[model samples]
Target: MAEAQKPDLGPDPSLLILDDDESFLRRLAKAMEKRGFAVDIAGSVADGKARVTTNPPAYAVIDLRLEDGNGLDVVEQLREARPDARIVVLTGYGAIATAVAAVKAGATDYLSKPADAGDVTNALLAMTEDMPPPPENPMSADRVRWEHIQRVYELCDRNVSETARRLNMHRRTLQRILAKRSPR
Candidate 1:
């Protein structure tokens, strides 16, 4: 049986969800489909940019970091292509600076990764002047710090010394953080 049409949030029901994580993208697409979006999925910045220019959706969910480039590039292009489109930036390593940047680049909202379809829907359909509610499970400060460290480490090709040098921290301290499990 087909699910009923979701409540009208806009004239267009077309939604685009872009992410490099294949499994998460697929799962979110499925859930959003159930919620009545005509979903399109893209796995890279280039593909997303192309899609935006050719056929921009009314709503978009883009990841912050991708293999090719920052997702903010896509957000800017989509905003240019469809000025009224609702775009949400999703990132696993969320930060205050990046959140502000996403907004500045024309994103309608920003969400941390592992967000459920319900949360995405609420954001996509929110009133124009409404202030978004806080995330259901915002990352702890320790978790955010750990994720940032891991990101820098990976960017430095997983070289502890280089990562430490770039972060301006001792090598041993970086090692200890890397060895420990991620904080909740």
Candidate 2:
């Protein structure tokens, strides 16, 4: 007699992607679906929360900030709904504090923004005990510095001198950096 096949005991590969960027959200949803996940997407925290309450997925990739509110709120809801769910938080404004908050809020992993579908899939499927692979393209030190300066400039209400003072950088140097396009 033929041997019986054992049933697959893994959780279903259902994924929810929440981001405010319209093009990015649709593109990511399609890519994830092609990669064997049943994907549901939302553009705002309100929509994300409603989706979680209605049908929480086994996996989630949520942006850190949204027009409606913080994505951490959605993460909280998902965690409450599915404690075992694997959630990855994505953010353009990467910071140590927020990354810690994400993990504490039950995120399986935290990734800086512009993370591709492949990265998202890997993060969702990675073993919780294992460390995630390093990013394919980590930001350079110059780029990080530029980003920090830009953030400070914005927070200073775009006052060049104030931003320079806050960053402890020279006013002329700050102007030159601001005039130039962001480094990769």
Candidate 3:
């Protein structure tokens, strides 16, 4: 028998692309739109903010630096205006400090430009994918927990001490978390 059709599990309803560079914005818009997304482009922070206020998109692609202001400011504004909107930050000069700040500020993800359409699309999908059932539903808690531990570990770039510091826990405590998360 054939498998039943799944419901529309697409990225988002629409995309709001913000960048000072017109060519980049246009290309990204065209690419994303071709992939079944509704895309809107804004050339400046003010313009982007205005568009979002009028009609918010499901996701926003932001540049780290803008002609009028910094991209992080735009990220903050977008979060304030539409908390549910997923934000992806773009920067030509990727800084670890900025990446960390962006996450704390509620960015779903960050990418260093010259990113292509595929990278943006994948990140959006990953951020907005349906949540899997929690541990004990189907997947093993140990496995899931280990995955989480690994992700956090990698986020701190495999520095357990730094990861613990970032998590606001003692290094030994973070070690225990990892140990508990590990498969028996």
Candidate 4:
């Protein structure tokens, strides 16, 4: 009998990750390198765009909020320049609206921050395949409100004071929103 052949599972061609958090970027790059990806890191949206333009990577992981600009611009550029590139958005802000926008803007996947290396790996894997299901709909007003709250809430790491401050509302109002979202 003939011997069976095994499929090859080699390192990916290349990957780029963009984020303002230097420590996180460095750690992520190292982890991905161990996983056999030739990784590049960019600290700002402009740098990310420039790198992509100069030499596009097979995969890109972007943060939705950047110090220089919103990460969506990078997403748009990637869509135009390298349509086959797999893109994933990692955000501290993950509201339904932004998630919807990310999908429409051509991101392959979206994940909340505090995401682990595995999350990043799975996201990359997901992007290489066809898109998965859209987020559920007929969203209740409360659900929508909750999603908004989560987006901003996570953006500020559930700090009522900071989230309220950023949202331009009284702390009490932000508290009330959270209270309403929480089940009795």
Candidate of highest TM-score = 2
Q: Please give the lDDT score for candidate 2.
A: 0.87
Per residue, candidate 1 scores C-alpha lDDT tens digits across 1-184 of: 4545565756689999999999999999999988889999999999999899889999999999999999999999999999999999999876688999999999999888768888898888887799767767777889889989988898899999999999999999999999999999
lDDT of 3 at 167: 68
TM-score, every prediction: 0.84, 0.90, 0.63, 0.69
Candidate 2, TM-score vs. the true structure?
0.90
* Global fold similarity of model 3 (TM-score): 0.63
Instruction: Name the runs in model 2 displaced over 4 angstroms.
Output: 1-9
Q: Give the candidate order by descending lDDT.
A: 1, 2, 4, 3
Local accuracy by lDDT, each model: 0.90, 0.87, 0.75, 0.78
State which candidate, 1 or 2, has the greater TM-score: 2
**For residues 6-51, could you state the per-residue lDDT of candidate 4 as single tens digits?**
1122445588899999999999988877766788999999999999
Q: State each candidate's clash count.
A: 0, 0, 0, 0
Model 3 alpha-carbon drift over 4 Å, by segment: 1-12, 128-184
Q: Show the colliding residue pairs in model 4.
A: none
